[model samples]
Target chain A: MSKTPLPDDKAMLDDIAAIVEKTGCERKNLIPVLQNIQDRFLYLSEDAIKILSGHFGLSSCEIYGVATFYNQFRFNPPGKHQVKICLGTACHVKGGDIILENFERKLKIKTGHTTEDREFSIDKVACIGCCALAPAVVIDEKTHAHMTPTKIEGIFLGYEIEKEMKIREEKKRDDKDTPA
Target chain B: MMIIISVDDKEIQAEEGTSLLKVCLDNGIYIPNLCYMEGMETPPSSCRLCFVDIDGEKNPVPSCSVKVREGMKVFTNTPRVRGLQWSAFELIMSNHRIDCGSCLSRKACPLIKISRHLKIRLKPFRVGHINSGNEDIVEDHPCLIYDITKCVRCGKCLHICEKIHGRLYLTFAGRGVDMGISFFGDSDDETIPCARCLACVKICPVSALLSYERYEHSPEGSSS
Candidate 1:
């Protein structure tokens, strides 16, 4: 995957401003405003919160408290691939903890943390409503059922291989365009 | 309008639509409460300590959230009410890392008072403690020390801060069982507003929020 440069402060402010223009600056519409921000940027940026605070006539702390009260928002910049391990009641019964530990060990990052390269982030869900699958691990958008420690390694390796292949394909196209 | 309500067989007269807990406490009937403050338009029923069984209602309701009504029959110390109050108290204490001797508010801690009144231990034997998995103390604020373990999520500090400064600097962070106050300011913040407004430190029921010097002058650290 190609690495995109971080959005500049001006661009981020403009995006937030556009969202505020549609949602207005009312205090009551904070959830919708935050949701829109979350959808635009996977996680709420500090600049976005500050811009929203100014637009809504609210203090930064006040907006921050609201954003945190609901667990929906995350302040960290999201990684490209999100690995969600379901630790639901059924999943837990069927060795979900082991599966989670395996992922954490393999990634060299604990749950709710992203790798330094911003490629993978691990998250544990209370439930994904797939109890029949028991121990389920969802990477990006696809769910893998009955995940074991060996299976988790294989899956992550596959992701890395796919990523490498995509990079190689992009390099080939670039070479063709430049006519070397 | 004034309304007469019977609380634990005592006839008490209070303003209608006011908090039942306030009415009972005003009339020398003590019902344990944490979040309720005088003159709050809406009481955040976060603490869940002031449970009173009303005659008509099937379940015990938090007295702080209940409005005083005319001819209302309320039982604060009934077996059912006591059971529910104790449960709530234990629930709050379950997450609370209780250490009385080291606490800054040891002399005036509400948890101690509630435990004495409710006959429940500070570290409850009934419910196993739920680890928050966060640091015991957060010293990130420029001028304050937040003890995450001691915080009961009572919202008293939040209320008082909102009243004094039009909003809270130490607002809630996280959600569900992991929820607690999050001081949004950086440790290196030059313009620390909380230094002037120690309202949160003064208002906290469990002494979760304290001034920077509170540790040095803590009961164990200094002579009183």
Candidate 2:
């Protein structure tokens, strides 16, 4: 069986150090430090957490405990695209849970897990502040309103085709750049 | 200084600035709570079980987060308060492993006691069970054994760990529904730094954390 690769600790530490510098490396700046690190890495890595613990004079457990108290922080690496299904009151009444289950089935990954190919990840958010557009699904910051289980396949296909076209265009650009 | 508050039409004197939940609990008044960590300055109020109706307030407020005030009128058994508490208790039990019949701590488990007090039957809710199949049991430590499935994320263990040890070796990892308490570092030989004070195990409310020896000697045939 192939072994899982370890994250580049040196690069991650550098990014964490930059965040700590920006956030002032204080115990009280824990949330901001975690937020900035997550913004840079899409999730809080073990190495980043260790660096924060050292900088803040807190144990790794302390940092991890505080981070887990909130729903915003993530520990695993996120995917290229984040798929968020709104589970707000309006959305729930409009069958948002069904839409979420369909996405989970289609992606073959549960909520809060990245796909094996790192193409997408799913999350059930409390709300996107758009109750008027009940049953909303947000993909990479783009919102799709009035979503249904049947519309999931079309959305997946659209992203797949878009990704294929982008790959082809990049290949063409590389060919033009190379010497004939 | 002492403050007077009326709870269920009974006038009670409590220490000023103390949490209403603490006053109610200390005075033999039952207000169900799962996340009220003792000596915590700011309560998380995540459990939503200690909700109480206050005079002039339209909605029931969480008693653990609110400090007592002089001459405040509080109602603990109002229909709205009971309804909200019951819903919160049911929500907490929804994801919990309800195998009390075979649990090692069946006699003294706080989850069982609190649920019994709240009159919450172990029935399934519409939210469904979160059978994630991620019940990883950690038995590396000679003294402690952590069962990930039974955890309710009360934060009591972490708080008491820091309170007693002045440093935390255990922590909650991950976020959202997948969050679970875990030990730091990868070394099996790290020799679980806990002082064996049993602070975390005693503070755990649920039977998630148990003494390894106690678990071994407990009744057999129980699912982990």
Report every candidate's CA lDDT.
0.82, 0.80
Which 10-residue window of candidate 1 chain A scores lowest in summed lDDT? Answer: A1-10
Q: Name the lDDT value of residue B3 in candidate 1.
A: 77
Candidate 2 stretches greater than 4 Å from native: A1-23, A27-45, A65-180, B139-143, B186-192, B220-224
Please state the error at residue B88 of candidate 2 in Å. 0.4
Each model's backbone clash number: 0, 0
Output the number of the TM-score-best candidate: 1
Q: Where in model 1 is the C-alpha error above 4 Å?
A: A1-9, A69-72, A105-110, A129-133, A148-180, B1-6, B10-18, B54-59, B66-73, B185-188, B216-224
lDDT of 2: 0.80
Error of 2 at B213 (Å): 1.9
Q: Per-residue CA lDDT of candidate 1, range B1-224, in tens?
A: 98798987888889999888888888999889888898888888877788889999999888887888899999988898888888898898899887776777777888889999998888878888988767677877778888888888888887887788776577787778778788763334555577777888888878888887876688743653
| Clashing pairs in model 1, backbone N/Cα/C closer than 3 A | none
> Considering every candidate listed, which one attains the maximal lDDT?
1
Q: What is the alpha-carbon lDDT for the whole of candidate 1?
A: 0.82
Reference contacts recovered by each candidate, as fractions?
Answer: 0.56, 0.61
